[model samples]
Target: MTRILAAALSSALLLASASAETLKDTLPHISVTGEASEEALPDRAILHLDIVADRLTATEAVTENERKTRSLSDGLVRQGVPIDDIRVVGVTLQSVATEEAAPRGAHGKHVSRGFRARSELSVTVNSLDEAASLLSRAIDAGSNDLRGVEFVVSDERTRLERLRIAAVKDAEQRARNYVEAVGAKLGRIIEIDHQEAVSATEANGRTEPLASASGVAFLRLRPGVRRLTARVSATWALSR
Candidate 1:
């Protein structure tokens, strides 16, 4: 009985392998790579602000940082911005020397004069028209450190779907062109592999710094357009 079962399993494996080989031999397919891209004006802006302060004690430094952050958030809200859009991204505390440390001693030890605390704020502006005004308000409220703004598209998923359709059409067109050139006719599609879409933001311009009489400084930014790309690879059967 054992020998019979072993023989039956071996026969089944052989038959399966033979079937796979036959299928491969009968179906000849051609593979092609296709790509499509679309561009849309950025409808959103992400700005990073840092509230940094240094004090003799860590607690004092952190307190000052928090106070400034609160002011900034309140200012953003007053500007008709949504409360959910303003968030604290990160907080950091570091010991920093007020002046350059003296030359290394025999013990190889350095002294820090005070602790610097930094609170990072992230604000997403949905309305590009209000970006400049909001930025100025945040700075005036108490945001001491300013980082550049990033422009992005809000309706990215819709654009991506459109690109997918374009990509499939592009593949079909190319396949047809190839088959015609080779004196063959394109048959039904046997396989399709959709590649992940690649997207990038093209910052058309930078923000110019604005200084006010109250020692508030911020950048006036322009939300530029971004480009999105989709790629696909397809395999179709060929015939004479």
Candidate 2:
């Protein structure tokens, strides 16, 4: 009976030691987040325009849209816009007006066959000076629809890479400061988490239509600065 009791006590001691080790390994650590921002001039601008035509039948609508699109393309080519930069993004033919149902006492009304066809093209203009003129010419050439324009930098990948490195360094410095303040030492890095960066236009000016025959308005293309932000959360072990 004495030998059996000794063996049971030893097993219980070993189990307790293992559980303590596991708890120590799974302890939570401190995590800190840091952010960095940089601003630079945008290098490119994207213009979105649409050509639309309505007719009694789909065939007529499509035909008229094709003619208008061709004319717009020609005008862009004359303005030195490259063919590769121009892409047809969307094409659709849909009913402009739906048939309305009659009252309970009246018969159902016949639906009209009127249809409108639209062709949308995305154009990338490297030169800001020509943007207004190009738009005006396209409008004169029969492009009735004009969508808002968006500006962007072509070398965004390079800018983001630099910002990421700066953000990581900033996060490390912040962690060090926190550890020093607490009178503790920072140990090995346990984990790292990164958030998606955002870029946007902080300011913009109102646009006014220009009186030009080319359907192009005189635009004031002010290339504004784009802000790139990067955030990182770092977890570091703390030691006393």
- For each candidate, the alpha-carbon lDDT, in order, equals 0.79, 0.78
Model 2 off-target regions past 4 Å? 1-28, 98-113, 199-205, 208-217
What does candidate 1's lDDT look like per residue over 115-136, in tens digits? 9999888999987667877877
- Candidate 1: what lDDT? 0.79
lDDT of 2 by residue, 68-131 (tens): 8988888888889999988899999998766578988887766876999999999898866577
Candidate 1, RMSD to the unseen true structure: 8.5
Q: At residue 41, what lDDT does model 2 achieve?
A: 76
Among these predictions, the greatest lDDT belongs to 1
Candidate 2 least-lDDT 10 residues: 202-211
RMSD of each: 8.5, 12.3
Among all windows of 10 consecutive residues in model 1, the one with the lowest summed lDDT is 196-205
